[model samples]
Target: MNTPRLAHRPVPPHRPYRSKEFPVPDTQTQPLDPVALHRDSVVFNALDCTPLAWADETYLGKLAASGVTAINHAVSVSQGYDAAAAALVGWQHRLAETDGRVFQAYGLDDVTRAKETGTVAWFAGFEDSKPVGEDLWRLAALHQLGLRFMGLTYQNRNYAADGSGESANGGLSRFGRSLVAECNRLGIALDLSHTGERSTLETIETSTKPVLVTHAGLTHFVDSPRNKSDLVVRELAARGGVFGLAAKSGFLTPDGLTRRPGAEVFADNIDYLVELAGIDHVIVGTDVGDERKYSREGMARVRRLYPEIPIVGADLDLERIHPEGLGTPADLPLITELLAGRGYSGEDIGKVLGGNLQRVLAEIWDSASGE
Candidate 1:
């Protein structure tokens, strides 16, 4: 019998899945310990595009407090090759500056080593193919510099494909097919978070490796174009891919701009994804970033950049962008707490937290170079 490419890998009994060690009161009046559960699990954040310059001592301290094993850091997006290369080099220097607090991760072994050493492993990713710019050699070079996952487009059209904001819903271009094939050859996973719906489905069908929607929600909850349809979600799971439930309130509910969404909002989305795609294909990708983005100035700047969503209206409160109790990576354990309270088994929670994403990466990142 052929095993599913991204089948669930259960945690060993010897390993800590969850226990009653750290007692916390639950709605069911049972003992549930989310702290210990999160501490013991290999939590991986599939998408984090926070600027590298923000990784100062306090920021790094917050990351250490988050208990995350690894993160797919966006090195560049919506930019050309030169700018993207500079951004990548800048991240390398920032990682070096961490002084052993952070480790550059290229594979599962590196993730294991980071978790063992109590340091965060960071792998580089690109949110668009504009950086490669008609040169497959440039793509290989970026891969050499540690680009593990890449999207075909951001929220706009590029040389490869139309983005989610495009009206035409055009499929992948000839160059886009080449991009998908090159990503497969170079051990890089494809991401479809911001690609057009048609382009996303086509890329999944075109690639030999499993694709990832690194940070997105479901249209079943929020009717925004940024959210995936149930059809896309089902197809993604059928192809052995994983879906990351984003924590952005704008994509969680229709009234998100009017009020503060609590962690329950995220829990509900997680529940929906699990029910629709099964436990083994669901994971978390809280898209929280530097606190400055919540400020009026930052919000205005963002509005100017991507006007398609028009999320930041004058009347909308910036504080409502991220769900309460999950405003940053430091609060990620709350997902574990919420899931546990919802009666999810410890092993299943482990898969949702990071194991599923870990398995998908292992399958997609497989190549001869083994880099």
Candidate 2:
């Protein structure tokens, strides 16, 4: 069960922050034009666990207010098939009850409407494809339920493939190959975020349609087991696939330990990917979860363990939090502005925001329908 070790890249010299003491600016010196900033820029959220994170309707409303074009709702991961199916059913019920407020995207029209109205279009995606069971027919059933995208596995070995963090690091299983073909037939886009290296490469070679690594980072930047190699990034891009940059703090830094400065670090990752793979293949896929409930509980637990420094609620600043700016979904405009400041053109920004993902989705959906 020996996993292949990732080849290391020389760590870039850490850039000195403008102000290390204060990560976030207190006030905006120049106001960003919201309308102008949002123009041609479509935010494609690769992962959002808000539904599972918040009980308050206000939080959901906050997300809707964010002007996000689309979100890939993770329905299954680290859960059994039955549980995964149940989660999908529950999400569908929520969407129906919400009455298109959080509508499910089954085709291009759904995405079009999301752009026009500014409502969040939810695409059912399984964080792990373990729920497909041993039978390939289950893929069709899941697709009928609006499961458009699926990862082969989560952070462990499954029937289909081995995860990136798994010790075995096996390639796609026989059942995994069948599942990939079925996904091709059904028009589902295979995601290889948490999948092992061998499995990911094998999947890229096998799938008829383009694939997506919905949320991940470069192992060269951060030595985390979850991040992919630069070689894999190049291979995926060459195959017409999209590599969605994840927002997870650990995955983006070199040490995979300390939290790097928010927007700056995010920009660095973007620049790195653009250097390796063209700008057209890079997209933002923030795997941010709702921290409203968990933060307090986690803080309380931490206080019990280490009561030396009293960490109060005031110390929690969502604005400067994470290496990828945090302030619910509403803060996406800031990212666009940051990208622009980094000298990226409007077209490049658009591709990073949503165009890249749209291309892959359209390709996969068309292939599925043709079958």
Candidate 3:
């Protein structure tokens, strides 16, 4: 019988599936006593989530155990207004279902609240702006529904701008620029994570408030269409924005080594970003999670979007998405543990973990909270 095919088919270019891969440092299972530092520190994730099924109590338990203060949860995707509204409301209901363990975060204070109360703060974001459709007025209502940010594109062309893969790299459309102003006015942060480099830089130049590339890597490391260039990153820094270092191995390394990249590799990426962008501008935004089943389903869903190619990610099993050792929210302590071992000062480590995001959020959100 033909062997069952792997759910994630490998694509050309980075054949990471080849048995002989780059030699990674040994420490696949190295155990470390959990660091107590994160407990007191506000451990906010700029972008990432693999929240458990709402019905599962383990979801709430795992979050507390992981010490996650907040995350930019992707509650809606390329959806219509009604569907997106349902998602936004559903998330609020999820938090209520948790009986106050997780709270809806609208401002920097909400994050502080979560940190102090030992709960996870959920800041809702959209992976794309399609949910708003042609009507600019919809964004106002959506913002009221607790939608905090929206990516102009999902690495593909949209009404706002060209995604990473689009040949139309002409930057933001006229309507796109209009929406940017409205978002600035309405306190909805603009996330450039999945947008084209040209569009991203253009958005930065256009925005009055700081824009975020929530879960991205520098092209200086792994040069991919999805990664940002030095020019773009420098611009983002000069504008007082933050580049959230991602944990996905593909973004971390060009070889597509997400299968077994240890937490040390993630720490090294942090070090590089800090060197390039300085500590205050660098932060963690791991697009990872612990739940394998949900993650696999998430991948399949994304793949359907690009039926012609669906080449968003390297071909690897669902397990590679989170990487080994650094797989779940609970494993987050490992990064802090490694950072401490690397001689990072508590203040610096604290900034890398969440303090940086706190600062940016305050300026961007609070300054624009007028709307």
Off by more than 4 A, model 2 = 1-35, 53-56, 293-321
Query: Model 3: which residue pairs collide?
Result: none
What is the lDDT of every predicted structure here? Answer: 0.79, 0.71, 0.71
Clashes of 2: 0
lDDT tens digits by residue: candidate 1, 1-371: 11122333332221222323322223255454788778888888888767876778877877888898899888887789999999988888888988878878888888777878899999888989989888888998989988898888898989888898887888889999998888888889889998888888788777777789988888998787778888788778877788997788778877776777787988888888989988888877876766653668777776676665525555657777888887776777888999988889777788777788877887777552433
**134-235 in candidate 2: lDDT tens per residue?**
877777888888888898887778888888766677888999999888888888888898888888888887777778988888887876567888878977
Best by lDDT: 1
> Which wins on TM-score, candidate 1 or candidate 2?
1
Q: Pick the candidate with the highest TM-score.
A: 1
Q: Is candidate 2 or candidate 3 better by TM-score?
A: 3
Worst lDDT 10-window in candidate 1: 10-19
Estimate TM-scores for all models. 0.89, 0.82, 0.84
Q: Please give, for residues 1-371, the per-residue lDDT of candidate 3 as tens digits.
A: 11112122222221111101212112335433336566656788877655435425665566677788888887775778798888888878877877788878888778767766777888888888988787888998888888886777787787888887665565889999998999888888788878887788888888877788888777877777777887777677767778886777667765554345556767777778777777777777876655643545566666676532222354535555544666666666777888878877766667767777777777667777544
TM-score sort, best first: 1, 3, 2
Q: What lDDT is reached at residue 99 by model 1?
A: 86
Prediction 3 TM-score vs. true: 0.84
